[model samples]
Target: MSNPDITTPVRRPRRLRTSQVMRDFVAETHLDPAQFVLPAFIAEGIDAPREISAMPGVYQHTETSLLKAAEEAVAAGVGSIDLFGVPTPEHKDASGSQAWAADGILNKGVAALRREFGDDLIVMADTCLDEFTDHGHCGVLTTDNWGHTVVDNDATLPLYATMAVSQARAGAHVVSPSGMMDGQIRVIRDALDAEGFEDVAILAYSAKYAGAFYGPFREAVGSTLQGDRKTYQQDPRNARESIMEVQLDIEEGADMVMVKPAMPYLDVLRQVADMSTVPVAAYQVSGEYAMITAAAQNGWISREPAILDSLTGIRRAGADIILTYWATEAAQLLA
Candidate 1:
C-alpha cells in the first residue's frame, strides 16, 4: 500500500460538492424570497416609466408603472417594497414640505401599494427629504455663527417625526429614516406613538456612508445637491463608528437597522448584524447595481451569476434582509 493517507485523499471535501443537489444539500447559507427588499422610485409627474441611464434595467416609474412594478414584485414573492418619491422640480422647497404632505408622491405610493396588496405585502416608505429639498441636503440648513451652511440637526428631527407620521397614516408598515440626523429614531418613535401609530415599525439607516457610490442614486432621484453630505453621513474610513450608531439607534427604539451601499461595507454590515438585537438590513445601492450591470453589459462578467453571487456574499456576511434594485428578479430566480 502506497501511503494510504496521501494516496486517495483521506478527507475528500469534494464529496459534498460532487453535484448540484449535493452542493445544495450542504450549503450553509441559503437565500429566500423573504430576505429581499425592493427599492422603487416613483416620479410625481412622469407620463410613463423612463429607464435610468446609469442603472440599466431600473426605471423611474409613473403611478401606473409603479403599480405594475408592485404587482410583478408580488408575483415574484418579494418580501417588501421600499418607496422613494421623486417630486417635480416645481415642488422642491427649502423645508422639503412635500415629504410630509398627505398627497405627496411617497405617501400616495404607499397608500396605493397597501390598497393593492392589503396585508399580503409589506409596504415601506423612505422617510428622507433629500429628493424633495431644493438644496438637496437631507435636512434643514442654516448658517452657523462660523458662517458655514450646515444642516440643523435639531430642526430636522421634527420634520422626520412628521414624515414618519405621514407615512404611517398612508398605511406604510415601516418608515425607513435614511437621514442620519441625531435623535431621529427617538423623535420619530415618539411621534408615531403619540399619533396612535404605536404598531408602526422603524427601520433606521444607522450606517449610511457619504461615498462616491451614490452617483447613480442622485440621477434616479434628480437630486439638486450642491455640495456633499459629509457632515451627517458616516465617513467611509470608520467601521467601529457604525457599531456605536447602531447601538444608539437600537437604544432609541429602532425596530431594525441598516447599512447602506452593502458591497463596499460588508464588514460594517457583518459587525452590525453580529451585534444587533433586532434585524439587520444591507442596501445594495444604485451605484453597485449600475457597476455590475455595466460590467455584465460589457461582457466582463456573467449577469445572472454575478447578481446571485453578490446577493449571496451579502447574505453570508450576516445580513438578515437585503435591499436591492434586483430584489424581484433575484427572488424569481431563487424561487
Candidate 2:
C-alpha cells in the first residue's frame, strides 16, 4: 500500500564481503602460526640446507641450519617444530639401533632445540625407525613362515619404547610414533613413565595409511625401502578401521592423535576428531605439498591463495594442529 515498500529489503549477503576488514571479521576459519608444527629433516653430514628435488622450497638442514630454522619458526609465531633425522647410509643398520642411541641424530637435534629454544617453542621428535633403518621398514623386520619379510609387531614395540625414552631424555616435549606398529603407544608410555619422564607426551600417528602420497617423504628421509608399507599401515579404502586405530592409540595412552595425508583423508580426520577426547592433528604430507607447489609453479594457480586455502580446509576439517612444510610462510602471512 505504501508503494509496496518499493525498495526491496537488501537480502544480500554481500555486506559481510564488502571489505577486507569485514571479510576478516566474518571468516569462519583463521590460520595462525600457533596452530602449525613444522616438520624438519636434519641430515647427519650436510653443512648447508639441501633441497629435496621433489619438494620445492623445502630443505634438509644441517644442525646449524636446523637451529636457524627453528629460530625462524619461533620468530614467525609457530608453536612447535617436529624433527626427523637422515642418518648417513653407513650409520643405518638392520636393527635401526641409532634410533634409540643416546646420541642419535634425532636425539641430538632434540637436545640442541631444547637448549636453544627451551620452553619458548615445543620440540617434537619423530620416534620411528624408518629413516634410520637399512631396510627402511618402520619397525624391526622378521621372516614369516612363507619367508616374507614382515614387520615383527612384538619385537618392534621394545625398540619404539627405547626410542621414546631416548627422545624424552634428549628433551623432546613430545614423541610422535609414526610407525603403525601395534602396542607402540602403550610400550612408549610405560617406558617414559619408568624413566621418570611422566610429563613427556605421546602424539601417535593413529590413522596413517599405505598411500602413494608418501613417495616424496621417503625421498626426503633418504629411505631405502624395497617395498611398500602396506603390511603395517592401514588400507586407504577403510575409514572405519581408522576409528579403531584411533581408539586403540587413545586407550594405549596417546596424548594426541593424527591422520596423515591431511587433504585426501579429511573424512578420516573428522571421524577421529569426533571420536577422540585428545587433540587431533592432521599431517599435510609431502606429496600433498608437491602437488600444490607444482601446480602453482606451472602458473596453474596462485601459490599464496592455494596454500592458505589448503591449510584453511585442513583446519575446517577439525585439525587442532597442522603439520605442514608451509608453516613458516603461512605464519609470516598470518602475522
Candidate 3:
C-alpha cells in the first residue's frame, strides 16, 4: 500500500499513453487519405516528370505521367487531384488565351483523366491566369495614364468565366478560381450555367493572401511575375477582411472556399470555418511544403511525424479538405 501510494498521490497521466492500442483508442484527431487532394502540374510534351529543385519530391508531369499519377492517387485513396498546366513558353501571352483553349494542356489532361477515371476521382482545375500568363500576374494586366501596371478587374472577369466553362467542358468536377479578382465567382457561375454546366462546382480561393509563402509556387508554375499581388490578393494584416471576401464569394455562388498557406492563417481558417455555410478547404502552399522537406533533409526533424503533424494541425484548425504537395505521400503513410 505504501509503495503504490506515491504513484496514486501524483495522479500520473502516463497511464493513458502506456500502450499503442490505448493511445490509438483515445486519439481525438485522425488523418484520412480521402480528405487530401494532390496538386499536380502537367507540362506539354515532356517525356518524363521534371522535378522542381526547390520542392523536393514534386514534379511537373507529362500528360502520360499525369494520368499515371492520377491512377496512383486514386489507388492511394486520395479524394481528389487538382491540376495545373505549364504551357510552352511560346504559348504564353498577355491575355493567357491558352487557359480557355479547349485543346490546351490542362484541358487535355482533364479530358484524359475523365476518360481514365470518370467519376471515380474528383478532378479539379486551377482556373487562374498565372500559369498561362506571360507576365505571371493572376489576371490580365494593363497600364494607367502614367504607365503604372494595373490589374483590370472588370476586364479580367469574363476571361475567368471562359476559363471556368472551358475547365467544366473538359470534365473538371470543380473549377478553383485563385485569381482573386472581384466578382469572379458570379461571372464564373453565370458562365458555367449558361454553358449548360450546371453540375460543375466552384471552389473559390476566397481568402488568398499576398504573402511570401507563395514564392515556391511561383517557381513551380514557372511564373514570370515581376511584381507583388498586393492589389488583388488579401492583405496579410487583416483577418476581418478575409471574412468579407469569403462572404462575398459565397454570395456570388461559391460551392466551397479555401484559405491559402494553411498553417500561418489557421486563425483565419477557424474564423472562415465558423462563418461559412459551405465546406472549407486549406492549402498547405508550396513554401510550407518546401520548409518541412528542407528541415527533414537536413535531419533537423523526423519527416513522417512532421508531415502528419502539419496535416493534423490543418485539420484540427477546421479544414475539411487539405490541398497539399504531400497529399500522395501522406495518403500512402495513412494507408
Best by lDDT: 1
State which candidate has the highest TM-score: 1
Cα lDDT listed for each candidate: 0.94, 0.93, 0.92
Better of 2 and 3 by lDDT: 2
Question: Cα RMSD to native, each candidate?
Answer: 1.1, 1.5, 2.0
- lDDT string, candidate 1, 1-335, tens digits: 55555566778898899999999999999988787899999998889999999998899998889989988988999889999999999999999999999999888989999998987789999999999999999999999999999999999999999999999999999999999999999999999999999999999999999988999999999999989999999999999999999999999999999998899999999899889999999999999999899999999999999999999999999999999999999998887
TM-score of each: 0.98, 0.97, 0.96
Can you write out model 3's per-residue Cα lDDT over 59-138, one digit (the tens) per residue?
99988888889888999999999999999889999999999999998999988888899999999999999888899888
Residue 34, model 1: Cα distance from true site in angstroms: 1.0
Clashes of each: 0, 0, 0
lDDT by residue (tens digit), candidate 2, 90-117: 9999889999887778888899999999
Worst 10 residues of 1 by lDDT: 1-10
Give the Å error, residue 114, model 3.
0.9
Q: Which candidate would rank higher by TM-score, 1 or 3? A: 1
- Taking all chains together, the TM-score of candidate 3 against the true structure is 0.96
Runs off by more than 4 Å, candidate 3: 1-13
Tell me how far the alpha carbon of residue 40 in candidate 3 is from the true structure, in angstroms, after superposition.
Answer: 0.3
